[model samples]
Target: MGSAAPAFYGRRVPLFFNPLEAAAHRLSIAPPMFDYFNTLGLHALVAAARLRVFDALRERPSTADGLATTLTIDPRTAEVLLRVLAGLGYLRVKGGRYRLTRTSRTWFTTDSPTSLVAGLEFWERTACVIWPRLAEAVRDGSPVTPFYELLESDAALSRSFQAWTAALARRQAPATARIIPVPRDGGHVLDVGGSHGLFSVELLHRHPGLRATVLDLPQALEAAADHPRLTLRAGSFLDDDLGEGYDVALLFNIVHGLDDQEVAKLFARVAAALNPGGAIVIGDQFRDSLMPGRASRTLLDLLDLNYRVATGGRVRDFREVARMLRAAGFDRPRHRRPLRSVVTELAVAVVKSPSRP
Candidate 1:
């Protein structure tokens, strides 16, 4: 028999990653041959975030040399990075001094309620590790290991994800609260997988008679704020006791992370838990619902692929969601775009009751 070539994946792939060198290249994009698999353009921003470049600039406009002294970076190096950030539109440069652009102030500072800084950390520390093995997930039609399993083991990665989720929730919750059809008479809501509990808080503020329970895993609920009307129920929405007779069940950004069978089961469970005439509002990125060439069409498709790689899940169309809901005893569902967001929309269904009929 001819000698077999050395195997590719079953053994150690040589790692050229140097933490110091990676840190040294902090202000620049890693060369194409960079050790980790981060996407190209993002590395520049990641480097700046890591170096707290945005934070320093936010304090006051500063020349490269001044920032270098404050940040303990070499002046020459800081100049190059500052110029790059300005070019990237994250900062503005004039009079040899750099300062935060509106974009940076809104989304980069850690203190900003909608800050996306943790997004970079999640991508670098968690998502990149999953990307290299994405092919296996695709070919197998499931994630090699589900996303939460990985997070369960890595506290740092989990915290980064939680922070990102919370920031995103803060941006979207108010709009969602406005759009969601809370019962007019004021009843209970089941906020399924409501990790950050921002939605529940918003709903309670909007409707005085509304009481909400945010059901999610215990770890995800750690940062969830307590409210007299908002109960944090730590458990699985898939297998655990979801209390019955909820007036509204909000499944936001959830279904894309579950398989079809799991979605069907969960929908049935949701059906059983809702009161007569109660509505279910599912907020998610539906790939088929986006118009062709829409601004967020690509983002929706990317999320579909990302979900596939992370949880054996894929995006569903409004039709698919409606069919599942109908099978679970809901009336025909309506797809509504309530938020200014192009990607996330709601598919709402109501449990039929004799009074409503």
Candidate 2:
């Protein structure tokens, strides 16, 4: 993959401090005044994505009128959208035709392996629904219905969410697989709540002798890949059997959606499902302790709110994660950041003898 996808989201370090937010803080302005929305350019990008404008320009350049004819939209609106896209550097106009920039061609087109189209669609479907209801969540201390429940009821939303998450898993799989302590000779691997199965697939690719199982909801596994070395089990990781005698278990990006009680129970369940001497790798954006305030890790701070709004969950800090692991009968967990993307991290814990307490 190219380097753009990582940077497109954000950087690992803060480039500058925002004195405006500080001024707002001094004046006691509501946080929403600054935090409520993205810049208009981002909203434009999302609109273009949902409209499939990037896909239209993927194969060949087109004038605004030509694109409007192809997409069956008002020519004037199409012209404005194209101009906006071009102005934002995602598109370039030459000889009265518009085309994708190199970064756009690589990461935004549907044909690209690293396409972020699903991500944009997902943002439209999920974030748009979640953010507007954030005040209610903050007030009631929970979403009216959890985001997963909402997804379960709506097929289109569920598919969009899965597609986006799977795209993310594909990009992150390589970076994640490297740090996980999979046994050299290859033993059983369990991927708990591994909805899209890309992580397990990556591990299988790396360790030829490894066999893996992806456990997730039935709806989530519908598009999961079938392989000779892979098994797909459909069920809730919280309330179902996790199967025993696993050498390595992967818990990736699923914890932020869970409550503290649920996390404790799930970790204990996974610990029981693993064989003695097995390792479990937990991956997500843990709350950064050093820079936990609004000035730094801003996305993470937003994500902490996102979790609360979407799932009644909050980002757990490093020490809290280790405490959960230790309470589940594992030793102190070791932390690793394979990609250094600042969006996610890994914590590895080993099961001692007599695996389940």
Candidate 3:
């Protein structure tokens, strides 16, 4: 009947059925389900990082049972975790032994120079906890827990935040120092909202003639290392008087947390704090300058969401930033060469002389 309906595999098939089309349909339908489970891989990776699995593997390759014995984890659990990590390309497995891949060795090992363990820890501990409340943030148009308020309530979390941020800052500071133009002549540098002060320290190292003053919360500054060329000022960037006549001012990774008015006010304060010929270097991730890739765009969007949830702030577009800087009575701003990092592009803007009459 009807030419046997193109029977295949001893079953009748629809006359219009196409194998390619069926395969495409299957793929289209599978991604959402696949994506849901894919996220679990990220969580597992973060957990393994926290548990120092990579660190243990860094010492030497070991069978899952051996690793379990060394780390005091269940053997079956360790094997499963190791298998997952191997599947993810962070580890290599052969002869029932696992070892860190070059990628993991470079980034996951605690002792590696470019290790990202601290930054990853920050994501696991802080951002991961907050992300579950994203729906509430979307509904309320803000994060369920304000970032600063959360820090205020939890001393341990606050310390962890500082440590992770400091670690991340240290990783990027060298590249940032290379890109930004520091005046050759010795001049005072003001770091507004410079929590860890690593940027200032790196800059001071680059320019021995310069001295830096870091203004941030007392808790954030408590862990800052003492330096002959560095001074730590404890207070709010919003209410505190940023002392005047500094040759250069830094507003690094600070603008995204503030609303437009606060950002404008901050620029005004920075303008007031600088010497007539001084420059204010604003270092942040400008939305317009993000790297050209789908991954980068996705990351930028996530960061925008993160800011929106945590502080009712957003990643500023370059045009908006320049407009704000102009409104704050600074001359036209110039963008320096951008430094691309794992998280965001380190964008630097140098404002011409302050317009204070």
Q: All candidates' lDDT scores? A: 0.78, 0.78, 0.75
In terms of TM-score, the best-performing candidate is 3
In the range 196-305, model 3's lDDT, one tens digit per residue, is: 88888888988989999999887778788678999999888888888887887888878898888888788887887787767777777787776776546766888899
Model 3 CA RMSD to the hidden true structure, in angstroms: 8.4
Off by over 4 Å in 1: 1-38, 291-295, 353-357
Q: How many clashing pairs per prediction, in order?
A: 0, 0, 1
Model 2 local distance difference test score: 0.78
Could you arrange the candidates by TM-score from highest to lowest?
3, 1, 2
Model 2 per-residue lDDT tens digits across residues 173-205: 898888788888889999987877988999999
The total of clashing pairs for model 1 equals 0
**Residue-wise lDDT of candidate 1 within 241-316, one digit each (tens)?**
7878899999988898899888988888888889988899998877667866532564566677788887888888
Q: Which ten residues in a row have the lowest lDDT in candidate 2?
A: 1-10
Task: State the displacement of the C-alpha of residue 201, model 1, in Å, after optimal TM-score superposition.
Answer: 0.8
